[model samples]
Target: MWRRRTLPAVVALLGVSGLGLITVGVTADPARPPRPPVDAPTRTHPAPDLAPLPRAAPVRVQIPAIGVRAEVVPVGADAAGVLEVPPLDRPTLAGWYRHGVSPGETGNAVVVGHVDSPAGPAVFFDLGRLRAGQEIQITRADARVTTFTVDGVRSYPKEHFPTTLVYGPSDIAGLRLITCGGRFDAGTGNYVDNIVVFATRTA
Candidate 1:
């Protein structure tokens, strides 16, 4: 398991791993310049915030900006309170933090995925490429689709991940998408940082 982000530390969202799976050679592009540290407010509203939708588990997620369309599976924290990632072998699936509010609801809903696997780039490999004004669509079990407008994308060193800001309570419907990034550590078989995308329900 990766460094534990216990329930207490992150409040309701539980754990998140900067290292999703052990990769063979895929890593962050060393040539790409690093992004400035993220200091944005906890919630961002590009358009008027949409009212909270009824409780409905997300079934699918589509990020057209990065061409990511994947099945969404509910995953809870393990006994050690570490947030669980999708099985390494199933790299195309994204794991939703089932314990938190569902997408389009009134609080933060989180989804996590691997940037890569032993085979190659995974579902969220291009997550870091997303930018503000882009949109993320989540299809729920109730057949309702909630669209969110990207507020920002930030890469944080694992050690400095803002637990409350990323996973904390929100006044309006919010969404968080997470994956690993930064330099790859050959010794640890993980990345040195995490990429987080923040958005608010726009429709």
Candidate 2:
């Protein structure tokens, strides 16, 4: 569970801003087919001998391919026990799971951001465009820059989110970038799918 203070702050900001519920998904669109479950086998870096770094808080994340460069903010579960996201007002800022292992550590590090806000497409709007073998960089407080190589990208319905597969512990440093995707459902005011990018630390 996360501290309670942030929830009220988020609610206060969102209530005044009129930003609707920010859950992941895309409404029905004629051009694109419905999103399919991603069952791609996980791929690791060839250099398994490399060691992970000591735990350190992540300050920022950069993905050159999709032009994502955002500040990292710590977040935990909200009052409803759901993972909290960065405020819609600050869509460009990504939220890191404070309870999870930090990026570059020997475990899965989760980062989440909004796909869009009422104003326009947000920081992670282009996250689904990333392909395997692309690079993701994390700048840490210790001044060490860790680079991760994308293993694969997956999209799953919110109803059947793969909790274990995404949040499971790993022997090597791993990273997961999550955002909204698929067709939007205006009636529900939510997207129909979640886009997840998996990567392993390379340096």
**lDDT values for all models:** 0.75, 0.73
Residue 116 of model 2 has an lDDT of 80
Q: Write the per-residue lDDT of candidate 2 for residues 31-119, one digit (tens) a residue.
A: 32223235673684563666778888899999999788899999776554466788877878898878778998888898888878765
Model 2 worst lDDT run, 10 consecutive residues = 11-20
Question: What TM-score would every model get versus the actual structure?
Answer: 0.84, 0.81
**Candidate 2 global lDDT:** 0.73
Q: How well does candidate 2 match the true structure in TM-score terms?
A: 0.81
Tens digits of per-residue lDDT for model 1 on 131-186? 77789999999999999888888887777776786677788888898888787776
**What lDDT is reached at residue 129 by model 2?**
75
Inter-residue clash pairs, candidate 2: 25-191, 25-192, 26-182, 26-183, 26-184, 26-191, 26-192, 27-183, 27-184, 27-185
